[model samples]
Target: MGKHVVCKVSELPPGERKIVTLERRSIGIFNIENSYYALKNVCPHYKAPLCKGVVTGMTLPSKPKEFNWGREGEILRCPWHGWEFDIKTGKSIFDPHKCFVKSYEVTVEEESESVETFEVTVELGAVVVHI
Candidate 1:
């Protein structure tokens, strides 16, 4: 496994995502509530560019005639098939146990730490994806 820097922390604000190619693998790096998460860009079903889909919330379980929405900016909606996935876990909403996208561990590295580790000068912090 290796760490690949995706972008500066400032580049991807809260509720934003950036798709990058690291080690010839296309991965989607997301910033949800100040935390970073990485998912494979390819959709598990049809090989669509999953990162290009919309980021949205899910409808929570509620009593009849009531609607509850939660996990805003944490659900990824597939552009082609309308399949929803949890951005944090890359799991499908319908079949979480069997169907899911590939996910990677993400981290935010301080400029000083990156300078020493990667020998690169950064202004603030960098988003890193481990693969």
Candidate 2:
């Protein structure tokens, strides 16, 4: 596997997604709960950058009998089409088998002198090209 240094871990904030272009490819890195995950930045639905989408989670009904509900922290909604996806697996919530984003491998390395600062590597995964 080839490893490409993307950016420093300090550049990203927790629970946020950042878009970075590597080797002419647009990739997204998400910092969630002290861990990192990478995916293609563009949404499969409309080619919109997924980094611009809203980070959300599973919704639980506020009132079991009522239609109102609250978010639960497992999904992300596409900003352009409102499509939701499982953040951990990049699978579409609406259709599990049919749609998914290309996921990448990420590695974070810390400087020997300090644990507060680190570097990040983003590895490209399966390429998905829409026809």
Candidate 3:
């Protein structure tokens, strides 16, 4: 696995995401509810930077055909057309079978002794895309 130091854990704030370019690939690193996740920054629909989108809990209709909605967990919504995706799995809630975003492997290292010691590494997993 290729491990790249994208940013320090302290650089990211909870419920926020940032775009980082590595090897010509745009990467989105997010800190949600104290956990970290990384994905391709570009929206698959139109290549818009997903990092520019808002991060919020997944919204689902209350019933099969109801207008009411409910919250699911950390999801990223594309600002361009409101395409929603589960940040944890990179899956589109609208289309479970065919939509997804490229996800990266993230490692958070916290010190057992010190409360402030921490490190984070972002890596591309088995799915490799050349920029």
What lDDT does the true structure give each of the candidates? 0.89, 0.76, 0.77
Global CA lDDT computed for model 3: 0.77
lDDT of 1 by residue, 11-101 (tens): 9999888998988899999999899999999888899999899999989999999999999999998888988899999999999999999
Best by TM-score: 1
Cα error of candidate 2 at position 50, Å: 1.9
Model 3 stretches with alpha carbons more than 4 Å out: 61-73, 110-131
Q: In candidate 2, how many Å is residue 51 off? A: 2.0
The pairs that clash in candidate 2 are 57-73, 57-74
The C-alpha RMSD of each candidate to the native structure, in angstroms, is 9.1, 11.3, 10.5
Over 62-128, each residue of candidate 2 has an lDDT whose tens digit, in order, gives 6556665444445778888888877778888889899988888888985455444445544486554
Ranking by lDDT: 1, 3, 2
TM-score of each: 0.84, 0.70, 0.71
* Residue 53 of model 3, lDDT score: 85
